[model samples]
Target: MSRTKTRFAFVCQSCGFRSPKWLGRCPGCEEWNTFAEESERVISGGSSARPAVPYPEIEDLSLSRIDSGIGELNRVLGGGIVPGSIILLGGEPGIGKSTLVLQAAEELSRQGLQVLYLAGEESAQQIKIRGDRLGLAGKHLFLASETCLERFLEEAQKIRPNLLVIDSIQTVYTESLDSIAGSISQVRECAARLLRFAKGERVPAFLVGHITKDGALAGPKALEHIVDTVLYFEGERHQNHKIVRAVKNRFGPANELGIFEMTGQGLKEVDSPSQLFLTERAPQAPGSAVVGAIEGSRPMLVEVQALVSQSNYITARRESNGFDRNRLSLLLAMLERRAGLHLLGTDVYVNVAGGLALSEPAVDLAVVAAVVSSFRNQPLSAKTVLFGEVGLAGEIRAVSLAVTRIREALAMGFKSVVLPANNLPLAEGVPKVELVGMSSVLDFMEWAG
Candidate 1:
């Protein structure tokens, strides 16, 4: 009698690690009490395994990149899509990640390039319907609805398209990886295989990935490390505009951004986001002030609105989504202690108009102005624009790239600006905006008063 070969199955619930049966901890990596018993499909007996072949490196001079026909996207991709690159796109659900690539494929295909779009999440009919609605006219664009990795690879080899898109890498699976779809091991294995295929075949692949609840790409930490580029699709759901930011890149500037507005047809480029952010401005409105901030290389003027009201609640609740709340409290304290504004009986509320989460300290001046404007029942002058950093000691501080902010304000037709006293290095030969420099937060309060 011959000894029999056996297969075992196990799963790690904590990290979702699955493997062949019972171990003290997990041989995958030494994590105690992480493994659990799981029922998984096992393969054995009559099977031929092909030896793995290493992908030979292509001569860099021989390979080339093709433009995606979108100027901003080209900038984000470092002047277009490299022939053997693997790019991962991550975003919130229903944020139009799929629609963007679909439109890109349609545009590229119409330009006489062969393209293949593989969607494991959507059916071929569904994609075709969206394409028809988008009014794309091209015989070269192809679509396949498949999720199996082996079949997908085979299909790609047959099609040999100029550009290949997997609607999402999260949906793909490989025979060697026992982990379920979307699991860490599964995503990692699938991505590695796809990367090898893309490199060896000289095919550029675009992967739309699912974002975690924390807004990061969902998968093992290694998954992100495997890709050549990572882009974040960010924006407020209520707003029509979406900002595509490159978080990591090998070929492009890291902070590059592409702005698009979701429309009935598809996403259209927003040439002037400053105009978009301020087009709905309410002139002479108390508690509303314009703030200029830079996102990537683009300068935007967003309005900061605040309302100060009498409140009997002891907590005096401070809340802000796009703007920092702790900073708001410090500003209020400065107003009360140094600037002599009465806030003991008031509730203060602030909002960064357009729902943009502004992180830079540059919004400080506008925030202070909005609060002061509301407290005094006076409207901020429409001709005024502001930027600066506020300090704990009620002192106004210098901010980064001051001249650029002022230049953007002048381009937007704003006549005056209130900024840090120290940040004025004037732009030469340009019609300039009047720069009002202040030394302290108290100075702004006095000015507003």
Candidate 2:
């Protein structure tokens, strides 16, 4: 009997970079003190290689999607969940990741689909308590408290469930690698095995992933590449509403947004997000402007609030929430150079109401309007909405989907729209709204006065 030789190497936890020896800084991810030693058994000799097969025809193959009974979730998933797809849901701790998955599982089970939920961090009793609290009957929802990937797969093979959910990928480990559960090798290997199982069984799987302190998924970067879709929960945990944004999706469009309200029962889908965001907005308030923004295919109305105050120190402070700080600085420079709003001695602050992040350039005009309103202590009309991109030359540029944005503002009861002069022709057919077109930021300042 020959003993197997064990090979050891240091691996970076941030990325799956391997090294022959340990170093203070990782050359792959450029992070310090992130490498951990891992070992694997060295197998000798090679087995007979299998021959490759020809590819099968997939043009005539049509897939039927499974509805999770959640409209917002289905929309984020590109209509419905595709079979054999692996979906990774990541969020900060206590951000309702488990609650959302359990609710979806309960709904699937209610529709006569057997759902096997493997809870790696919690026990069966804990999951049961959560389910009962969520008012789930759990007719066909099977729960298993297991962290070993091999045994869990064995049980899954026997059950042949329609849907599979792993409470978390960080806590599950495979025995083949001599590493801890949350280590890079273990997480990567377990995720790979799960992916193979899902593809072979043609069953859709949901993976709950933990996030790092930097708000990224806690695992090797390759974990995200292995999944078909990635959904992230965004918002403060103390808040009642949460935003689910799809950063990556293979079957559907990316950057899709879903709104949900946390209730005593479970996560409730928000149908009218624009209304919810504007419910508590104060009318006739200075420093506030409404912007018609589009997230994926859904058009929404969001509030952009800005505050301009004299700085106590010699250097002015610039801070922004739910909006890019660099963009704020650029906008401030443009305002000072073009609109003659002397902001060098004042501190500027900007925030997007309802914890919704606005990355689109169409909100530029609204941000500028809000800042001007705050600086001059004047309030714009509450029924007016703005959307257009501002260029470095003080020109208002036309944005995509102008008609869609106008229609959303109209539906939200906004009477007037301030848009780029070029987009007026695109939105000319929209009825019952006053269109105020601006060719440049100077024109906007004239309109504001």
Candidate 3:
């Protein structure tokens, strides 16, 4: 037999660039002294067992999906997994990214789909030990502990499973690509091959992606553009709750989010997000207030907390977590200039409880209330919820979906809602809920006092 042709490749380690010949500087990205060697290039076979079928005379215009039984995950995936779709899932290290996918695969396999989970990081026995703990027992499900793309493909073609999951893409190696497995060139190429296989064979594939030090999907920026859906697992790992947010979805709305609480039984859906927000609430605490913010169509009532004390240093130690510090400073300045808040000697600390990052300006009014409540040693009524945008002029400005926010508060048994006066008429005959409108932040303070 003729010897298989092998070519050399020079790859940059820092920038992840691959070249046929060694170079002093990388042409793709300017990183020095990072070039490495590759002996052979990955090759894609010019063959397929299945032939493409022509579209029928009857137009197929709608999507078809079988539920994965996880409502939260389904919502993020644009209503369950679509056949032949490839999803790129990324999260910080040790953030339960692998666990969530593995659990979903087991559930799908039990639902009569031929599922195959190929793990490059762990062996088959290792997967089973965890699976046993999860009580995942399926007769039709198959597990492979291989990492090479060629061997995985050979087994995949033979099995022809309905659902496929590669534990991670970075650990997978392909001889067709002349670069390291996790290199930009290799990753992009491997993903392209798998995507083709998915589309051509009508197999839904889930690939776990790694995040870089900068907390973005690792590999070339182009990798993000290629995937149909990108799901991010976000949360403080120590926290019981995990938020899977859909940063990009071709089939669903971008603002939709999924909430899962990690437990002994595995990740369970949090049906009432409002309760979860108040789980760790400290009642009657100064600088603590309930705020209703609308995220997409969902309304959430979250607690905003702040701490106030005398400043010793020249800089008043103004800091905020889960909320923007710059915005916090601006709000403080507005309070001083527009609302007459004394800030020359006071230190302010603010946090959005439960490790959530709140960027919605609707929380502005709440932040102001919490800070003032702390400063004045007062607490907002537990039965009340506040919603409004704070302007540079200290105006209690209007926020979007104010009516919806009020309705959410009402549904959560809140008796009154503080809102902008501009939001009037109240969604046509809403009853039993009091709406207190304020024109300025000072007006709100007086009402609170």
What are the Cα lDDT values of the candidates? Answer: 0.78, 0.88, 0.79
Highest-scoring model, lDDT? 2
What would the TM-score be for candidate 1 when compared with the true structure?
Answer: 0.82
Task: Give the alpha carbon lDDT tens digit for every residue of 1-449 in model 3.
Answer: 22455667776655556787788877766655657786664343555577666768533311766577789989888788887778888777777777787788878877888888878778888877777777787566888887888798888999999888887888787777666677766677677878888887888888887675354334634466777778877657788998887777776777567888987767889998888998889868889988998754588899999998899989898988878899999999998888788976899999988777778899998999999999899878878889888899888787788778888888989898888877755543567888888899989878988
Mark the regions of model 2 whose C-alpha exceeds 4 Å error after superposition. Answer: 1-5, 42-56, 59-62, 220-222
lDDT of 2 by residue, 1-449 (tens): 33467889998888878999998898987888888899976444555555766678442111588999899999889888888889999888888999999999988999999999999878989988988999999999998888899899999999999999988988998877788888888888888889889987888889988885373345835588999899988767778999999989988999999899999898999998889889989868899999999987888999999999999978899999888999999999999998788999999999999988889999999999999999998998999999999998789999999999999899999999999999998789799999999989999888988
Q: List the residue pairs that clash in candidate 3.
A: 13-34, 41-176, 42-175, 42-176, 42-177, 43-176
TM agreement with the true structure for every prediction: 0.82, 0.94, 0.85
Q: Runs in model 3 with CA error above 4 Å?
A: 1-62, 212-222, 312-318, 344-347
| C-alpha RMSD values across all candidates | 5.6, 2.4, 4.3
Leading candidate by TM-score? 2
lDDT of 1 by residue, 96-129 (tens): 8888888878778878988888888798888888
How close to the true structure is residue 297 of candidate 1, measured as C-alpha lDDT?
A: 68
